[model samples]
Target: MTMSFGRFDLNLLRVFNAVMEERSVLRASQRICVSPTAVSHALARLRELLGDELFIRTSTGMQPTARSLAMAPLIREAWKSLEAAIDPPRFEPYKSNKRFTIAVSDFVTMVMVPDLLAQLRRDAPLVDLVIRPDSWIDLAEQMDLGQIDAAVGVFSEVPARFGSSSLFAYDDVLIASSSRRFGKLSLETFSHLSIAVVSLHGQHEGVVNGFVAERGLMRRSEMFDRAAFERTFTGSKRSPRVALSLPHFLALPSLLEGTDLTAIVPRPLAKLLVRSHPLSLYELPYQTGLEKVSILWPAWNAGKAPQDWLRAILIRAAEPLSANLFDFVRPARYASPTSQQEVAASA
Candidate 1:
């Protein structure tokens, strides 16, 4: 049965989309900032108008019917069109008071946020930032629902529907305490030392895959290049032993001070660690391939003014750091000729 456009309430589509996204009445209500009863009432009106059950409550949550499933994409597209029409074409960052939510790992936060925040303060004083953890399993859904504006990390593969921009490329380096004396950091020496690693997913032995498959989304989980470490010791009988696995980089200074434990960290982070702590940085024995970090957003938001402005500022903030990522690492006195050659290439 076809219903007249005049009688059908457009507002009901908002509630419907919320329900479809959340799959629970309570969650839908919270998402739309309405009472549960209001969501239920709106669903009832929508069901009656369309002459379909629309949603059925099961043991899990609200299950959309065939008709609801068919209508969802159309409704979502219409909402996107309406939103674009309502949003201003030009964004004046200095005068606009907008809060942007971003998802980033602790590592990226430590390295990039200070610079990004300073730029924001100078350029967009009224703008605010809400940072969410990048380890969230449902991050893709959150971005799709417009809850998160963008995410920054070393993503393995970004889906076609999302747009991404490269922020910087980084390679891995090994760090140890300055108090400890060490010879050339050959694979044998690297394997013998007790190793500390930054593992966001908490895998103790093997390297975590760049992306984990969850809910049909390729969510980024791992941070370190454990694969390179493992590959360096592939044929050796003795493998590198992991003495510690940490979720963050904050305690590395104290953790490695006056100890034999060494860590493999990103070159950018290694540079920061060495400057502030009594740490010595050494080039990795094997070349750990460079990983490119990027900022990802839903493709529909590509041409939007606020998103464009945010991306522009982010690129600007990372420029100085990225320009010197490979240049900052000073090779140890016992470094191999390869390490010296690598340094020269950066120059």
Candidate 2:
């Protein structure tokens, strides 16, 4: 246990790291560009030196032992440090097969990822993307530990060493079925009808802002604005009724069909969804202002060209969404011919 650092071969440790990640000697050998026998030998040496089985091959896979699990983080951290020091930072999307992991909301996945995937196929065909869920996870901590490459959402309070860039601005819009009765929707008309709201946090919790404020990470949970909804009518005896609360946007379309339920959601999302469904969008009756969507990454990843390049691509994809975001999600005073045309097209 007290062997000198010089006695341990770093190469064997690298093999240990690879086996831990790949969980198979053959796969680890392929990753390290060595033979399976060499990989197995390295693992054996490491197990002997560390005085633990390190990994046990089971029916499922090569499962790391308790000690291996305990030491995995330190091993990964050490490997990362070595790569930072010695590996030349390079990313050639066309030729490189690097996998990037990003944390984003389901809304973004629906609206933006199509364009992103198309562009990636055209440009960086070999590059791969791993999409992770945005909320509930510690965004900053995950990025720091290399679990997440970038985070794209409404990041409210980014912790130190994390980077962010504004992607676009969107406003909350009221989604209603075109068939739903109302020649002209008024505060009185809206007050009595049941509404659907996307719950940011599921059954157990709720927050003022979309992101979990308790965790100190700034991701969005802009499902509904209670204050804005309440403020829509100043002297009304009753507030707007919320009949349903769902966890995600996927079910909104089905839930709104053939019903009087109206949902308040982001303008960009509403616009995209209405194109296929018989839905209509209206500006929030009250002035709630624009909500910003942003791209977030670790500052340590800033100087790396591949990371920066991908960030640039994502920002580019979001540009067109923001250009006309304010036009339709605006107050009634800003109604123009173009806005009318957009609304008509959506309806």
Candidate 3:
């Protein structure tokens, strides 16, 4: 079972990779903390063993030969596989000082960041988190390019190459003023009434509009889709009656206060808003169904220690978000103050 290469030093591959990455023997030696002569000798031996030029000297720098270029990727992949196989599959939360970047929607960030930071502080205290607004088209690409470690939100479309896990589900509820008229909210009432919209991309039309369209509410849909028809509705004159269109869900409470603006917010956020502010929650005429939120990572990151740590923390944080909205297992017996605690802890 003991097979070995005859007079071939596998360490040369490491030198080759370093030089290829650095494009200069001197730089490669500096990177690997070795002498320039040692790097040159390793490259010479490698060129002879492979029977190819491997690298050609140019005015700009050392350019990789066709043969070296073809072999470099395979060599790197092999080294990665070998290292992964030898390492234990455990991420040390307290010891790691790694910086993790995550792409998330503004709504999810508003709801989950506090608790996430709290948990991170208690556990991996030194680790830093960088959050950026992730868009649908570029989410997977960002993960693929190593731009971000993970993403979280209501993902309408995700590439099959990426890995995703559903953290929790919550219902979207309508929040209106306490004095607003109810009992079968009519299209006239729906159309005439001003509304506050929260969108990550400053969109006027969203889930609520889609739900209204499903019910064949034409005039109401048009009102909801005002952004699309803005040109036709106000061709030459500016419409002054339209209320504020904000980006963050947290801003809705202040926008709605002393005004009759309505907004459809996630149930957890809606409850949190009502509890903290002078807002009221209303039962909508139709249900927009439960919104499922999930954390996504690159497929290449599966079984990775860093990915595992992030996943476990997120899943733990999502427990509170799922408790009140669904008939699922409660994180604890009493859901009110604790539920709010859970929400705030992850804030």
Candidate 4:
């Protein structure tokens, strides 16, 4: 008797990819536009065929098991190849009618909106574009699930597992009334002076907070010293102070003018405010260096036509405003998806 291999369902990989990408069966069903029952059945078939449970249920969604961990990269690569094989042969930038959705913070929008819009109008005139405001959204997850075409902003909330690359760097500069300098500021100055800060989530505990706290503690420690340096300056013990906490970066400029209050903002915003409002941009006495902004996407989208096209457009649009002008940096482009074997080995 001749031995023959049974044919396996190829669509099962699509179901598995969706689940792996979204990390939730219900969300995966939504992405694939199939019923949850259908998704579950497809996943069950995949589990039996691969002899792995794939993902174990968790409070924070499904966590991939060791076996599933070892299979994800292969699945991703297969999907990329499948997409390439099935994709339309040609894409006419000006003629093809496709809508793209992008997520970006208002700060990024303020800088790149004009040029991005102009480029779209000239190159992909018929292509519809939707610009969604940045929120506390899981952009990487969303990209993996085909929820958004691309994101243009800082990925501070992105998880380490996701691949990302730097788009550019901009400094965070201090702004205050020119005449309101209090000689040399002590941490006690923090207790006296009101400062404006920006955070998208409205939770102020990242770089800005860390820098301030470190300075505050250092200043407090130095106050007790009897050195000549301590004698040269008068200081006191006081709590860190924040008078008016503004959530939006745009509102800081108007709030700082003519007031004793000071605001720390991105260098570009500070420059704009200095030109518009009666504000002076001063380098923070503390050395919080320049900020680096990045663009991120799912590793699986590397070879897909739509994703490849979108990334190319973004890079092209961002090129003219390179390091010389906006201190842009070429981000690490992951040409291949991270293998599941690698992930499993790391674990």
**Stretches of candidate 2 above 4 Å error?**
1-78, 135-141, 181-184, 204-209, 213-215, 231-235, 329-347
> Could you say which candidate leads in TM-score?
1
TM-score of each: 0.81, 0.76, 0.61, 0.60
lDDT of 1 at 73: 58
- What's the number of clashes in each of the models? 0, 2, 6, 0
- Give the alpha carbon lDDT tens digit for every residue of 1-347 in model 3: 23346856878988988887678888989988999999899988877777888999888778988888678756755655677888867678899898898977656676688789999999999999999875333454455444677887765455655678888777544566555545455433444556665544444243354221211211111112334324333453333235656555656776777677877666667767766666666543333455577888766677778888888898777777766556423453223222223335555
Stretches > 4 Å off in candidate 4? 1-6, 16-76, 101-103, 130-135, 143-149, 153-165, 176-192, 201-240, 244-247, 257-259, 273-280, 283-287, 319-347
- List pairs with backbone clashes in candidate 3: 113-347, 114-346, 114-347, 115-345, 115-346, 115-347
Write model 2 residue lDDT over 1-347, tens digit each, in one string. 67788767899878887888777888889989999999989888888788999999988778889898777757766776688779877777899888989988788898888888988998899999999886667666567555788888876687766788998887776777767645445666667778888765654354554456533565666566666776676688977788888778999988887788888888788877777677766655466667788898867676677888899889878877877765663246423222223655644
> lDDT per residue, candidate 1, 189-281, as tens digits?
776888888766565332236556543456445556767777878888898788988877778889898888888788787766676677777
Candidate 1 whole-model C-alpha lDDT, 0 to 1? 0.79
lDDT of each: 0.79, 0.75, 0.64, 0.60
Count: clashes, candidate 2: 2
Indicate the residue-level lDDT of 329 in model 4.
25
> What is the per-residue lDDT of model 4 for residues 21-88, given as tens digits with 9 covering 90 to 100?
78899998998899999999998877776777888999999887877756776776777677778874
Ranking by TM-score: 1, 2, 3, 4
* lDDT computed for candidate 3: 0.64
Error of 3 at 125 (Å): 1.8
